[model samples]
Target: MLQPKARKAASPSFTSDEKVKRSTFSLRLTKSKKEKHMSHDKTSLPNAGPSYKGQPASVAKEDGARRRARPQTEVPAVFRRSRDDYSRGEVKVSSFSSPVGSSVDHEEEEEDIYRDVDEIEREREWLVCGTGAAVSPGNTLSVAPEVDILDYCQVEWRGSTSSAKRMRKGYEAVSQRFISIRRVRGDNYCAVRATLFQALSQTLQLPDWLQNQDLMLLPEKLMAKCTWITEWQKLPAKAENWTEEMKACLLLLKRKWESISEKKTLAERQAACDALFRGEEEEYSLYEAVKFLMLNTAVQLYEDNQKGLEVPEFSWLLFARDTSSDPFQLMQNHLNPLGHTGGLEQVEMFLLAYALQHSIHVYRLYKHGTDEFLSLYPRLPEAGWPEVILITEDDRHYNIPVRMCEETSL
Candidate 1:
């Protein structure tokens, strides 16, 4: 329950539709005259999904501009199932017969290995307060220790059955390709925390990249890209005030980056990285920076569609999910709030991949199988440099997967 406070909506002054100019990019605010309509339900998937058992409910196929149509109430295929099942922490398993010799004691032992998703709500009282120590603020980030998937299945599925074992077989196949599975906290912020952990960890290890100013300048670049974002950020209608807020955010980002990137030794850098992620203030501040970047990315896409230019296929996901074409609403309802039940969904992840200029590969495992579940945001042809690798079993929470033979601890 130790989560960041919700970010309040900026005042009405920030929502003004006016033209503003800045050095890097031009900013123009024009209200959309297009009547609010739901975006196409079908979003482009990197590849088709695997058939479950014999009932092959493959992912929606691609059509012109849109992917394929689904129910308006249902979320995109990439993230819907887990949210449906895991959000309430209910474990729904297949009715398949139990494996031979499966014992109650064995089930209990396996359950001990993994924490139930439902237990998260009561976590702070035990993990934080019960220890009788001054606990830091923000969600906790555990050390990424390598875990075996077959063992994971025992607890993940609870009572092992033929279906569970078959599912394990599929994961075993994937585990061969992606070796280390590092479990992350199962809170709503799982997606953001997992992705950033991979990104920042990569930045810290690259000696040639430590001095990369582009990473440092990312905030400014995003602001420039979506010049009208200042309005939604709710700065008073003064241009000067907006600029000041931008500067403040930038300064904060720089300070945090330097603390991690400036360390002379690997051990020192790793420690600094740990501190930043584990500390409440640093963790929350970084999330705010990321929220800004995502907001800009969404707005930029919205701008392109407004201009009558053909946006990329991924734009369907954004427009469809946010039918109103209102970036401010997306910010207020989805991105700004902290510790909300749902964190960043696939739509936001796609935007973040573009916003951060990093590819995010999410490996997913469904109830029956794990084939073709690997999703590359933006669906890049080749792995983007500084790629972040993560996996989700239930689709609701994400965990980092260290590639095979990689010495990286995270």
Candidate 2:
């Protein structure tokens, strides 16, 4: 008498008609949702490439035309928002027909919108590569395809020039030129390498070119170093015990890396009297040896505290910073980057600039010297000229730009 036991949950049975109505209701709702999704997604919807809901980008226009012929009451619920958006993002659908009172009704349009929103929220993702671009999960945003051309380019350039801006311009011109000449695109580096050899046969395939040319004379007279296959494609030295030559190459190559700040010219640089590389009599270490080579030969740097001994390579050369473009790796990868000696940086840039703009002419290299080198590179307006001039014992470090008027180029 106190309490009735909990009764079993009642199972309500329905007649065939009620069952059929419920099934119909669910089927319409699902179809309405799918149509709503296909309509809103402009990418997947074919003719909607321009803009129309519920139509593939291909047939969207035709479907839209047919939609216009129907009455407002006849217009499906899946298309209302897109049709309404006619005044906005989509193309105007003028003189459209009446909305149709379908099984789903106009409410299906809202359902589709909500369906798309739900999918986007569920699938979205992104990543941070420093402060650069992000990758979204949806195919809605286009992927910026990268341009690669390594085939026609077996060589890499590495250097800092007198002017960074001119150097950057030079690289862009070079990249554009090479891309055209090699016909490199997609997965065509292999073809590029083959074509590069064919087009630049003198540089890549001429067996006799470097045999008679001096490394120094080529830059002076040929506007090029004998472009030959590097003896060891893979270097022989290891990092722990890199050869003096290897160390020379790496430090020389270091100027190719990207950095945050612009560099100062010799005039703006703090005065230094140090010998960065040469160690004292008893304390000579391998690290010091590497440092000495890097400072005096590669980067052309002297110590900040003590130095009167002249390092011939570093003697009158300016230490330049290489900061050319976004994804700074492009130039080093594609162009012949650095010239070996410090004094040749501007000359290399000048030659690279010419090559970037036109097919290389050997005669351009010989006509002038330092005077020609100064005229082409990138620089701040105020950084005067170089003190360098023709072959003489009195070579100095003054900013006398290579010019006909100044005799610096002579």
User: Which residue pairs collide, candidate 1?
Assistant: 14-231, 39-320, 42-68
Per-candidate Cα lDDT values, in order, are 0.45, 0.20
Per-residue error for 221 in candidate 1, Å, reads: 10
The weakest ten consecutive residues by lDDT in model 2 span 23-32
Candidate 2 lDDT over residue span 153-247, tens digit each:
22211223323233333333223222312111111011111111122211212222113333223212211121221211122343443234334
Model 2 local distance difference test score: 0.20
Number of clashes in every candidate structure? 3, 45
lDDT, candidate 1, at 223? 54
